[model samples]
Target: MRSKTAKLISWTTGGFLLVLAAFRAPAEVTYFLLSTRLVGSALGSCVLPLTKPEDIAEARREMTLDQPPLIPLVRITAGADGINRDYLAPGKPSWTWHVTGFVGFVEGVPEILESTPALVERRQGGWFHDSSGAATVAFTGYKPVAELTREQIFFASAQLTANGMDLHWVDLGANYLYTVETSSSFSPANWMPAPGGSWPIAGTNWVDIATPLSGPRFYRVKAELKSP
Candidate 1:
């Protein structure tokens, strides 16, 4: 009886140690940003991160936005299997905005899991004519991933134009011309158009003008009409 008890104790101790070794905290998470240029150079941005529910809540409370940040894009939680699962409209305090341009995760933290491009969808109000006599309207959409396919790009472009706005590469009058592209590697620096030139004319759909900024990546642009 004594010998059998000793063996059982040893087995249990070994199993416990093995389980401890297998348990480890997750590494830094990566978040995705879908950026869109809003009116008056005010880039409205959204950030979507793969994170735990607690972390998401903490981030909202801890992080401060210099600009009026809107909407809690979404929240993701870890499952029993240790995978991050998305939970949209978690009924928590989130931010939302009518106009957005530049979307990204909070800087200096590797907690964000993925990011996507911001798509524009027109709402009922927030439409007006710009100084250039173009119809400028405000729209909202969610960013899912950084790299979008040609077809995905077109749908977003069409949605903007359907609302009576033209998408164009605005000349910031600085060294870089502002434009949008769909590339596997999405970055703000690459989205800019060449100086002294414009992107594929304003009316072309993303399919016709999808340009690869980097390897196997693509993007498109929509000119906001000042007067609808």
Candidate 2:
């Protein structure tokens, strides 16, 4: 978004030092020679293109030159790059130029948000998911050998008869954990794991430990997953 003054400065780097030279007692004279050269150099580069169609049409309509291709004698002095990166007439400051003159622009430049991106509320096709699951263990039927005293529930141990009862469960996920426990009484504090009470499987499962009419056994299923 270079300004006319900045553009002019660029073109005259090799010559402007001469102006410094002329200013010092130790310097050489720049003369009125630099003035005309500076003006000519600045104006010469001013013949540039309008990028937008509307600007081109506006230029054609308002053109005020004695010459056939003459555009307005005055111009905004900014090229398309400047107009884009800085400001165009619509957003310009309130000021006027006389003839081929223009004010140089700096500061108040529009900010560019190159880093921030649009918000995404949902995705269309692909998905990012962590594994999840549900599980249940059920004992279909059971019978007691005989009613036992509070003290006999454990040792008098009921013999579960051969009946059409079932124990089964399923877990379809990446990980599953289960425990089989037993108790002498239904008291919560008395439960403990039965013989080979626990096992770890690579969890993708449809498990069915369909034991029929079991003798006081409890089972619980838990599924879990960790992915990164």
Candidate 3:
């Protein structure tokens, strides 16, 4: 009888060990599956778009232009009174603006030096003009203050006149690439050699006489100063 009890006990112990082993197999498999899934998720999230050789070539071509990236830097800030405006970003105060679009239709008076025509009289900032054709107009104010003054201070100032053709505006579709202007258009003149610095009068650095909305316009300080 004792021998029979021992055999039964051994049988029960063996059964419990087998059941535990069976349950452990699935636990091990579940752990492996979870680890593999996490790895896959990490890899998928880390992938980035591959840069092809063609993309590099295109970037190089865009960089070869004479002016700043013509797409993003175009901006014009005009005041409600039509004066106290600014064309250039704070980072580039010396750059002027260019006007394109309907070159033939847009007409305006020949830019007068220090005349401060009624349109921009006493205005010491920036302005913009749209063209009537497919092109857009842009303008800049290149005023470099020679000095600054306080209660009883004085400064020297200069004028940059855009004296060429009269700018006329008409609604027309004539898409054309923006062509830079000549250097003579933005040459500083009438330099007042004085003892202080103050804001000067307004002048036509660049102007685009287009319809209400022509398109994107480009502005710069030395667009015409590019190498041939």
What local lDDT score does residue 14 receive in model 2, on the 0 to 100 scale?
30
Best by TM-score, which number? 2
Off by over 4 Å in 2: 1-166, 202-217, 222-228
Model 1 residue runs over 4 Å out of place are: 1-154, 157-184, 187-189, 194-200, 206-214
Q: Rank candidates, TM-score, best first.
A: 2, 1, 3
lDDT of 2: 0.21
On TM-score, who's better, 2 or 3? 2
Q: Looking at model 3, which ten-residue stretch has the lowest summed lDDT? A: 1-10
Better of 1 and 2 by lDDT: 1
| C-alpha local distance difference test of each model | 0.27, 0.21, 0.19
Question: How high a TM-score does candidate 1 get?
Answer: 0.17
How would you encode candidate 2's per-residue C-alpha lDDT over 46-109 as one tens digit per residue? 1222334454444444333222321122122111211111012132211111112211112222
Worst 10 residues of 1 by lDDT: 1-10
Among all candidates shown, the one with the greatest lDDT? 1
RMSD of 1: 23.5
